[model samples]
Target: MAKSAKTKTEVVAETPVPKKTRKKTEPVEDLTIAEAPIQLQAVENYSRFSEFDIYLFKSGKHFKLYEKLGSHVAEYKGVIGTYFAVWAPNAHYVSVIGNFNGWERGSHPLSSRWDGSGIWEGFVPNIGRGEVYKYFIKSMNNGLELEKSDPFALWCEVAPQTASVVWDTWYEWQDEGWMRNRRKHNSLTSPISVYEVHLASWMRDPDNPERFLNYREIADSLVPYVKEMGFTHVELMPIMEAPYPPSWGYQITGYFSCASRMGNPQDLMYLIERLHLEDIGVYMDWVPSHFPGDAHGLYNFDGTHLYEHADPRKGYHPDWKSYIFNYGRNEVRSFLVSNAVFWMDRYHTDGLRVDAVASMLYLDYSRKHGEWIPNEFGGRENLEAISLMKEMNEAVFKDFPDAQTIAEESTAFPGVSRPTYLGGLGFGMKWMMGWMNDTLKYFEKDPMFRRWHQDQITFSLVYAFSENFMLPLSHDEVVYGKGSLIGKMPGDEWQRFANLRLLFTYMYTHPGTKLLFMGGEFAQAREWNFQQSLDWHLLNQAPHKGIQECVKALNSALRNQPALHDYNFSPEGFEWIDSQDRDNCIVAYSRKGLNPSDTIVVVLNMTPVPQQGYRIGVPSVGIWEEVFNSDNPSFYGSGVSNTQVIETQPEKWHNQPQSVVLTLPPLAGIILKKSAK
Candidate 1:
């Protein structure tokens, strides 16, 4: 038993270790060679793939089709050219047009494959990097033509420009030492304190205040902030190519391309490389549940619901006003799975936080009685989407076992983090949305009434270990009149600070990994506005400064201690000393690690009145040292704290062999551990 207390795999070569040169695999089709006039010389070496790819793609298992289906620059025969291809099974004709070809659809037409594979390919000589391109596709169903950006583009023209750029994703990584040993830092036993950030709003030019920081600039700034704050990883909101700024990168148009709002694709690589070098794993929000209905995007591609469901009830997302992916389609599955792998393969991301998983798992999520169509089994479960999720998770773990797949699932979807073979979703972890909701709601109420809601605080332990979980105080909690973390507390400024500090202290001691959105660390006064930066000036205020100081101190303890994090997923790591102390609005627990001596006692007092003689059980008989006190003066507290050391009594208490009478500060928490000898 970890006197218990309590969190970032398998593909070896497929892990995408960077190298100076890559070996050519197979020849991809070249439409110029097949459709060009006899006098027009074709770039023969432009054949970047083989019929084997078509065979694999046909079966929907082609995970690297991005290598063949997008515009890529390479040497075919003797001439260097940009090879272009797209999956338009229902297109009558697909042409590659851009500034390189004078935007004339007829200038560089693609040749359809003879095997009825629905893929069109061609190569344009003299075209190279930095050139903008888009596919002019003629819909086979409606005979209507549409211009669409490459879904597999590595980079794109910064919004509001909707053009794909012929770019390369070659970055010389220097985090080799970090990548090779990431398993140690990302494992279940390791502490995972994630700092969720929105690149656009995390910070901005103080002088200009309007210009967004570039990826490199953020590396120089945000990277160090996270490192100094003792975060183990940085989970970014969707940085994928998105046009709408207010959507906050959630409604994505390009899965493969990083949002051009920040920088080019290589710039994203630089950002990831920087975070890795700092020993911080990088995780990005990946939205596979639904896509926007933008005309330039996947909606009605080829003049039909090619990427979405044919039925509106099954295809549309009423909540986000978007279109859902047709996960049942083999080609769509391949597209999504390959995109998931592409990040790990090309950008070296540590994990993906799958967004809107609840919507994907349930066909009737956020839908009224008749707004949804049931599956073939006549149930609420989305069978096709469930299959795709399993397959995606399987591929991700198979290719990179150490890499993580986290589901933002809110339902009682059993076994979300369990392996697929075990009849689960195969995710590495699931967001603890229930815990967040319950706990936050409990804390928001007045402490006088907290006794009536003790179940909210103690109920989490009932199923805390059912799935590997991440406790997230995310941006969703403090946006659009939801108020800031501190604002939710019901009291004067001082009590608010105390409650927020106590809340964070409890979160760190609880089971599961940790994730905190930006601004919550310092208790930013205003709700998060995606349009502007955080009120960083608040750091100068004593109360707000105290909150930040409390976070830093709490993070220090969370990082240095083993008992607090080593066994978070198992019941052995955590034991309730007095969970039924609802009358006093207090709870006591012990966190244990693998080593017998690695034990920490935690006591929380939620009321305004301090408990001077709070007797709590201790697993060890010795002098229990006060290692941390959230009520210390440095944290903007009233200086109410216990002496450094207090010896345990021999009398039994709370059903323990040993006990200690300690002063529990009002609206605060304290951590104690056995001193040496």
Candidate 2:
């Protein structure tokens, strides 16, 4: 029940009209009176402007205003002493409590004066750097007591008892044009395979479980492995400072600081610098959707709801049990936008993979059936959050055009990776979740059931064309009860090993850029556990050693093949040749470049039965040589199939000009390159 009314304004002034007499009507033109300056009529106070109109104004005028405000804020940069501000509409008094005051509450009360609005401002003189503090607010309405930290704190440090640390220091980046060069060389699918690894669990010295390798140790050891593996990028899973152990770095406590537990800030920068020097791109997992629940963290900072919404319904996430940010607020938006810029500008990181974007896009995202409310228009979308995300993307692209921002959204939200100008979420790329799920489901089925599921592999192309996608074997699918990729096979040990080889070969040959999680290449025997180290000894074992060799070979082949890299970004790059026989477990596909001369055909057999003289169609009529084979004796395979050097017959099968005959073996894959056209 909202009320609406309009009020009319009276004329304030009248202009004197001059009386004119026209003799004989010289060119008698009818003069119409101009509308009276569209009189200052008041519309209903309850009525608000349209969201698009507001956005237009904000994007133009408000941004200019913020630029002016930023200039004002910049004037105090590096000037010592403490300048503090708080927003507590419901609180009467707010005091600064911290180590600076010997942890006393009343010793150094923040002298805050309320503007007519809820905001309270104060400045504490000579409160130098590295001081930890929280706010003590007295609730006016309920007389409740509350303690909070600064929501916009650039740095916070409290020992073992407190979770955050002060990390406000300057970084000097020497790689001035490295980002530009990287973007120019790398595309959505330019052989840009990524090795996704969690730094803490990736390596642990046998002598120390509590004491893991620092950033320097990781860079020295892991970078060589990544370089040898031939992955273009290294995606770290949430390097931001967090509190919980075994939490996979998702519950971030410090938004602007690197995880201090790993190493010092300089060490993290050194890692990034080393990676850049090695010509490997680094992508950070950025989680701006939510913050941790720790009292010392972002929650209730500044003795009020500064970062998050004041309303619990809007602030709390149901499933994760975390606090969501109020993106509707301008300061919050600026903070996040600046954070993104800070990482790229300071660290020289090439890209970001934004985590849990679906959680940020909807109001009722993870809520139970009856616990959520819709907008006034009866839609469940959180338009304000969407707008903020869009603005953030726009800001990132404008500031750092070379840096990519990838989305980790699982929902079927259209255009999550589309350009912002196209009325979509502006992500450079998005995880191909549907393709991964469908492919995994197809792979998990028995050979007999695979015929019906074969379409799953081919049919994904329909939606895959919509956005740039990464074929990710992310950390999510490997850890916990989900089991490792090798553990998901449907056969004996040898068959399982062969199935994994087939899977990897297919993955390497797939159109999208691939991401293989740590220990996946070596075929770790058990599922991944965050608490324990990856089975490093597996590299010594013969079976696992063979898998690693195959991985290396596959990575090498992917890098060398022109067809694989040239047109790998487009729908036309991939063509399914055969999926007809499920019992025999044979699937064949081909990749072709924009130049017809560059072409490659791959055939895989997952069945126990070996067949001689198997004919598979090729995309070109030319001599086809075996470029790679997963069943080679060096890879610990049975080597039942002949190492055939076949020539394609002059035939146009399935619109292609070639067909090659080869011997096919159980649990093997063969990659063939057409002879030079």
Candidate 3:
């Protein structure tokens, strides 16, 4: 025993190894609970430690470490104050670099401390209000250099590089009281009748396509026209800052800043204010799905992957080739949430039509098989992105209770417009993409083919209850490879005009909110091109002007008739009376609820052959008076129908007495009024 320690060292050095004494080292057995207590305890400890490690891993402790490092930066909060924060987990030193700081990186160096988990923070006072800034960070790990802009920047204004300005300044809203009053009487009706337009292309000078007018100019030129056309809302394409000239503002570079190329931010505010003054609501096209591909822009603005996640699996939108924001990240969530608040609060926009919702809803959205990973539970992983959208809608509704948020979702996702707390996306309305596609296809068919297509128009009523819908002839449907709405008609010019008029009438009367494209009222002959001006000169022609006048009258009638405005919000408002006629093509429907005593029946004939004594089934037989005829000569069509006088009829069928037997002309529609008096 006394010689054991010294002998072990000496024995190892001097003694020869004995084959019998050299017992083979046994392989360690995997410890089980029933095994020896010491070994099992060690295994138990390891199992517990492993679980804790996994909890931290899935809970994003590593990501939080990055966040903690950046929280110590100077923060400004106010109506116009800039809030600055940075994320430099491994940075030994960080400084503010921006125009406000004279583009200097060293003067106001950020102080950072490792919180044991690799996070550093320091605050910079008075650095945010309209002051453009970036971070100059020095990495302690390898001296990696990085200069990053404020990820939560309300305004990032960099000329020809990043266009983000500090817009922390507040504006005095003179119309707050008016807005409150308007909210009291607002109704959620279908057949939304939206007129989508790009302010830049809507009315640029033909002589100079680039010489666009200011907000005031456009307001002055377009307000009267939109108001007269009876559109309930105007859906302007994205007015946010974008890089590409012909992107139609889809490739948004600035999330908060209005398109400076269009005009100053104040100009857009004035445009909305003026539209509100005209009693016409404005819905902005908001692209929250992805960012532009430009490097100087939102994509990786920090020189490292800050706004976007590091993994291409999570950060890249393959379809758009754009940078996808990490919705699962808090700072990124704050950035987008604040951006949404910025629009509604600053611009006073009545609503937002959220673009490309379907693209945002799926993790494997627009991806081929085997390109994406399923969630941990193995179902399609839309949880994180869907949760972000739900939060967005909730915040928007909570802040601006009266404002609407509409979704452009092509997929039949359930509860898209339901309250977020109800396990659904909280949207005020959803674009009836199905109704638009089905209705357009139905209208484009020949009368001989229409019978097969009539259900497309009528059957939409089945799912109408899912969400409040807007029947939009959106910019997407009228541009690029898609022909003009009028061009989609399967007939000659006159028949085309007739088809269009009938379509508009149906759109206005259908069971959803309605949206028409710019120049759709006058049947803009050309497809919408963002690079070119709308054919405003077409208005100078008689046929076009007549169509414009008809639109105006339709708007007036829509406003005047309580039947149109009252039940417009309800699915029960629209009831199809005839959906099964192929020969002599007649479809009639009645809009109920606005005025119970006074009902409006609309009958359409797309056939070229006129029918004599055409008996259309009336909901009740009363002296049905012809209220509106699309073929009235006053509207630039053959006056083959009666005038706009109220008709009285008694119930005839099913205990109804008053049914009118009249000749139906080809390519004509008649709106009849039933007077209970």
Which candidate has the top score in TM-score? 1
Quality of model 2 by C-alpha lDDT: 0.69
- The lDDT ranking, best first, is 1, 2, 3
Candidate 2 residue 518 C-alpha distance from true site, Å: 1.6
Q: Hey, what RMSD does candidate 1 come out at?
A: 10.6
Error of 2 at 205 (Å): 3.2
Clashes of each: 24, 3, 53
The sequence of per-residue lDDT tens digits that candidate 1 reaches over residues 1-677 is 01110000011112232212112222222223333222222444355557788788887898987777888776666777788878888887677878765677666667666666777777788877777888888787787778898888877777777878877676777889888999887888888989999999989989978999989888999888888888899999999999999999999988888888777776788899989998999999999999998877888877789889989898999999999999898888899999999999888999999999999999999999999998898999999999999999999989987788889999899999998999999999999999999999999999999999999999999999999999999999998799889889989989999999999999999989999999999999888999898899999999889988888888888888899888969898999999998899999999998887889999999998998877888887999888888888899988778874689999898888999999989999999999887
Per-model TM-score, in order, reads 0.93, 0.83, 0.81
Task: Give the Å shift of residue 551 in candidate 1.
Answer: 1.2
Error of 1 at 343 (Å): 0.8
Stretch of 10 with least lDDT, candidate 2 = 4-13
Residue 458 lDDT in candidate 2 = 63
Model 3: lowest-lDDT 10 consecutive positions: 38-47
Summarize candidate 3's per-residue lDDT along 1-677 as a digit string, tens digits.
Answer: 12332343243234232111112221111123112111111121111123343344234432222212222222223222222334444555566656555555555554332223222233444543344555666555565555544443444442354524444324445666548755643447433456788888888865677787767788888888787676767888888777676778888866666766665555677778777877777789888788865754656553456567677766788977887777787656655666676677767887888889897787778877876667667766567778878877877887788788889998988888788878779888888888888888888888677766667767777887678777778777887678888888878888888788777777766666667778788888888887778887887876777677777767766765666656654756767676677555677777776557656777788776666666665666445677677776767777777533323345363222445666666677777777555
CA RMSD of all predictions: 10.6, 16.2, 16.1
Question: What lDDT would each prediction earn against the true structure?
Answer: 0.85, 0.69, 0.65
Full-model lDDT, candidate 3: 0.65
Q: Residues 1-677, candidate 2, lDDT per residue (tens digit)?
A: 02111110011012121222212211111112211121111222211233342353334323221111110111123333454544455665555655555545455444323123334433444443344566666666665566654544444342243422222344565555556588754566567788898998898867987667879888988888888878888999888767686668898776666766676566788888888777788989998888877876767664467678877678888778889998877656766776776677667878889999998888889787667767668888888888877877887788778778888888888888788999998988888888889877877776556666667766666776677787888888886688998888768888788888888887888777778889898988889888778898988887788898898888888777877877666778878787665556687888887677767888887666677877777766667788888887667788765555588787666555667778887777888886664
